[model samples]
Target: MIWLVIILLLLSILLYLLLVPIIVVIDTINNTYYLELKGLAKASVIEDNIEVLKIKMRILFFKFYMYPLKKMAIKKSKKTKVLKPKNERFINSKNLKRVLRVIKSFNIKKFYMNLDTGDYAANAKLYPVFSFLNFYKATNCNVNFVGENNVQLIIQNRPVRIIKSFINL
Candidate 1:
């Protein structure tokens, strides 16, 4: 009877240890799924907002260039350059301010903008204030760019050092 009771106690301890890890894994999966769902929802909203902005741009351009004054001016002289209004030229400025306000209100921990080589031409179009804010916020930062199987970090215009001290050189 003594041996049987000891064996049963050992089995209970083994089962508890095994079940604890299973519970932890399930909780981790639940949290990951929740975060993924939230990311998808945010992406969808951003996509919709971009489509709306495109529509607004189209309407503004048509109203500015297709108006009666524009037609009369074109008939009068073909040399006049029909330029966009100052406010229309600065539409992106307002949008950038709105984005910065949202970022500040939410207290974003990190911000990233992925631009291709061709995008250099549009750097002039970005708001100077937004660029300044980004630079100010980037102080004491760790930025990593992972491409394919290569990982690199840029720290203050220098590459981060990777050390393996355990191995002899």
Candidate 2:
């Protein structure tokens, strides 16, 4: 009886460990995403290699997401620090069928604008603020434009699924 109980406990522990990857899959399916970094900060994308770490299941229809990138990213980035990253926001106004999230933002700075082409990049400070309120200083963010002509928009640090969208097209 004692040996059987010990074996059961070990099995449960293994199951819990496996849930991390499953949670990532579920959140990836449920959420919509985008990436945007205004300017010279945009160049940082060349060095980015982000990945999903985990997810928090709050309710059947809602979840609290988490990323750990402070030491690995924010502190390392030369531009745009203390950015406000939000995750619970939805993408389409007409359809709750899909969800959208902002993911990350950078500290404000000035960038050269190419008004005719409508594409320009900005330059931010060398150091980041590292604010506690900035999603507890996490990482795995990105920068890009998203959405369609009907509901056009721009955002940052979207999920891998959102990024894969362009490749499919």
Using Cα atoms with residue i matched to residue i, what is each candidate's TM-score against the true structure?
A: 0.19, 0.18
| Model 1 clashing residue pairs (backbone) | none
C-alpha lDDT of candidate 1 relative to the true structure: 0.31
TM value for model 2: 0.18
> After TM-score superposition, what is the CA distance of residue 46 in candidate 2 from its true location, in Å?
27
Candidate 2 shows a clash count of: 12
In angstroms, give how far residue 20 of model 1 lies from its true place.
Answer: 21
All predictions: root-mean-square deviation over Cα?
23.8, 21.9
**Candidate 1's residue-wise lDDT over 81-126, tens digit each?**
8886675554587666665543333222323443222343444444
lDDT of each: 0.31, 0.31
lDDT of 2 by residue, 10-111 (tens): 997665443322111111322322232221111111112364333332433444544444355325557767867887565556333223212221122212
Model 2 poorest 10 in a row by lDDT: 38-47
Candidate 1 wrong stretches, greater than 4 Å: 1-105, 117-120, 127-130, 138-169
lDDT of 2: 0.31
Candidate 1 TM-score versus the reference: 0.19
